[model samples]
Target: MNQNKSGPGTSLVGWNIKSWLSASVNTLDDADLELVYCGSDVPSSQCLSLVKESIPAWQSRAVNFDEGDFFVLSGQQKPVVIMRAKSPTEAQKRDAGLLAPSAYGQARDLVGRAVSEVRKFKSQKVNLRFESCQDREILGALVGLELAAYSYKQSVAAQPAPFPALGLSVKAELKDEAQAIAMGTNIARHLVNSPPNLLYPQSFANAVVELFANVPGLSIDVWDEARLQKENMGLILGVGGGSENRPCMVHLRYRPEGKSEAPLALVGKGITFDCGGLDIKDPAGMRLMKKDMGGAAAAVGTLYWMTQSQFARPLDVYIPLAENAISGKSYRPGDILRAKNGMTVEIHNTDAEGRLVLADAMAVAGSQSGSDKPAAIMVVATLTGAIKIGLGSDVAGFFSTDEALGQVISKRSQEWGDLMWRMPLFDGYRSRLDTNVADINHCATGSYGGAITAALFLTEFAKGYPFSHMDIYAWTDGERGALREAGGSGQAVQCLAGVLQSFGL
Candidate 1:
């Protein structure tokens, strides 16, 4: 839990990133391993000429190498890895609007897989150089390397012997930006991977405080049970009443000097554990409930990135922390609760508790007045399984009240390699949430279009502000490409960072 340490006993802190300008491989510093990426457009002979001494077998094989193919040569002064990556086609480059399209995703995946392979050979210190790559591609490659190097063994009983201090030297720029984004992603991953017992509401709030204790121009405020009661946040209290840990809210504001633009508001659902409340879930359904707070982790990561990068605009982050456990005090189906906005909601199903907590946080986010009013509001949560069924586990589905804002977010998501598709906020399904007993129902009457209905439920609290909601899976079922493990995917941090950059100005 100590944020400063780096080793197997703790989460992977970060890498020692060094910048290099020399393109020649022979001029590179000596390391245990060297990774070189060869683009499809580059000739095999041109790549082979970079190395002073070459293995005949590797050179022969490189001639026929296909995209995604790689070869390794060991037993020399230092091991050398050669990976073949495809460059963007003319049409792809034209669509991207970059003179030199980065092929950011392809570079990221290739570098990540190459790093994973070399690590198996016990190579710690590594050097990377790319052929025919621009700064964007280099940024992607650096992010990929940083992500692949992450090793989380916090729960291991006997910590494995620490490897030599891992370091990476790349012949590129953007070290600061790449490191900031990657570290933000790893921070989110670490928080999501933590067990529930160690990360309840109070502990989660404390961790956020500790993490941002030294951040300049940032102020953090936490609301305890008394403050929740004073503010009449009955929806949050109702969802967290079953647990002894109690529920709370954390608000973070980052306002740098000479910045008078409206602040961007971010809201995240911080359900530390979701056991489905009184309705309860089957064992299989409850196994990975600890990751229910993945949205909060993403929000935390985004804030960290924005502050570290010194973004031009002010920002506000609201996190509602709670646990939906089973106990005598747990809120049950058909219960009526009042939100911070004074809207009555009838809970039709206890399993749908994520929306209950997020609604109150969104209400607070949209309540800012005067010059302090938020320019826009964005909410992220793992609120419904219907999203997973509709978009699958790999893609996140989003809904927005403003069309222009939604289009910009969609475009940014594609550029950042965070796949997000826009879902319709069908007014036809709004009727499903109507109930005779209350102003509205927290959940829809039936299962069809559940994700749309969930988005509708939160829209009622948006206060007419430009609002966007992202429903993400947040957990990767298996390792693939840049995702080195089957754990927290860190789904929306990068995309949200892009969103802020697009609108924060």
Candidate 2:
């Protein structure tokens, strides 16, 4: 493992990764370990023959194996791990593309489990050979294998010895695409896992600059507090006033060669640390506030993948970075702030600060006129606890102004294994944000439908373009599937990347 110091206090470690799909038997011959999948009926003849030759006692073990069970045959030149996978019914196969915990998802998890098991035995190189599998399943398996090797730890003392270099070989052709998506996901995880002291607004901006410094056709711009004040972005400045580190916005533009259509705009809420300001959160609630910037991490990861894969589409990303801390200079609940789009917002609660910074960034995104206007706008944020209550932490909730666009995004999300549910924008909730003193109240009076009201508040600043807002719980609460531990889940990176790739189609 080689650590690359990309920013002031951030280290982006590069994994020694090599993954590809091969059909030839010669490929498996070189691997120290091999994984074979067995359906419910019985192990395949090749698998049985290998088992009998290598370890005859395993024949009875295979017959008694239950679904998701596995047995490792060791003490040979090459070790073999046999996994028992129940064959999916016809109904399961038909509905796999439309539901969570689908066959593809199960395959990914199974592969991830097998890969993790091999790593425990100190096997650095492995091969996975399936008698029969879909391309999507193969892709999932590759992604799972790559992601299973991800671990983030930054210590000043003697660091734990790095995991041995992993070389994964599968039997599919989607290695490049799967590797790109996994890399993007790891990028998000790395950012979200960084300590708050090392990842404030200024350092966050520096990380973005360093990540894309040498990439061609991408321009980066950072707006300081002075520039933000000059532009009258009071909402951003107000929320950031409590912190000495200050608030800033980073705008990234990627333009490919030749004439391109209007670019798509992505706005991310980059609250590096949210102590809930003067309206502070309790100790238990504030323990994981370091992941408050997961939305920005997803956006950064998506852009990084697009540039690396050379996805030829014009795109612009807007990130409003801030820290909602407590101080004498903190913006109060009664303060009314003016957004760049000339709308006044009465602060009802200082804790609801994510939407305030996003309001200004979206205003800037929608400010362009004529040919410069974005074709569509998408905003990503870990915006509300209400969404988690409604959809649970495993599924993200999104609201879109355009029904057709929403449908397309939903389909793309399902295909990529990043689960998202389309929540109603519900114009009926619009009245909740109305206030007597200012143009609108920053937050609703009550907690009812907090997610919907928040989306409605943001819609006011979307400027009538085709808009969608994704409310994500970006932190994984525990170990599950491809995620082997609790940390950043890289929630929307895969889904958003799928949406962008669909644009070119």
What tens-digit string does per-residue lDDT give for candidate 1 at 52-171?
374555455444454435667662577777766655567755534422233666677778887677668786556676777666677777777767666556323355434333344443
Residue-wise C-alpha lDDT for candidate 2, range 1-505, written one tens digit per residue:
1123221112442322222221122344466777766433454433455455555564446543433355677625677777655555566455444544444556666777776677677876666775456667767776776666666642222454444444444532366567667777778887888888989999999888877786667889999999999989999999999999899999998786674789999998899999999999999989999999999999998887676553558889999999999999999999999999999999999999999999999999999777668988899999999999998998899999987678877887777778888889888888888899999998998879999999999999986888999999888988877788789888899889889878635
Candidate 1 at residue 407, lDDT? Answer: 84
Q: Going through the candidates in order, what is the number of backbone clashes in each? A: 0, 0
Model 2 residue runs over 4 Å out of place are: 1-30, 37-55, 63-66, 69-78, 83-97, 102-104, 154-173
- Give the CA lDDT, 0 to 100, for residue 488 in model 1: 83
Question: What local distance difference test score does each model get?
Answer: 0.78, 0.78
In candidate 1, stretches whose alpha carbon ends up further than 4 angstroms from where it belongs are 1-28, 39-53, 62-65, 73-77, 87-102, 154-173
Worst 10 residues of 1 by lDDT: 15-24
- Model 1 deviation from the true structure expressed as Cα RMSD, one decimal place: 4.7
Positional deviation of 379 in candidate 1, in angstroms?
0.5
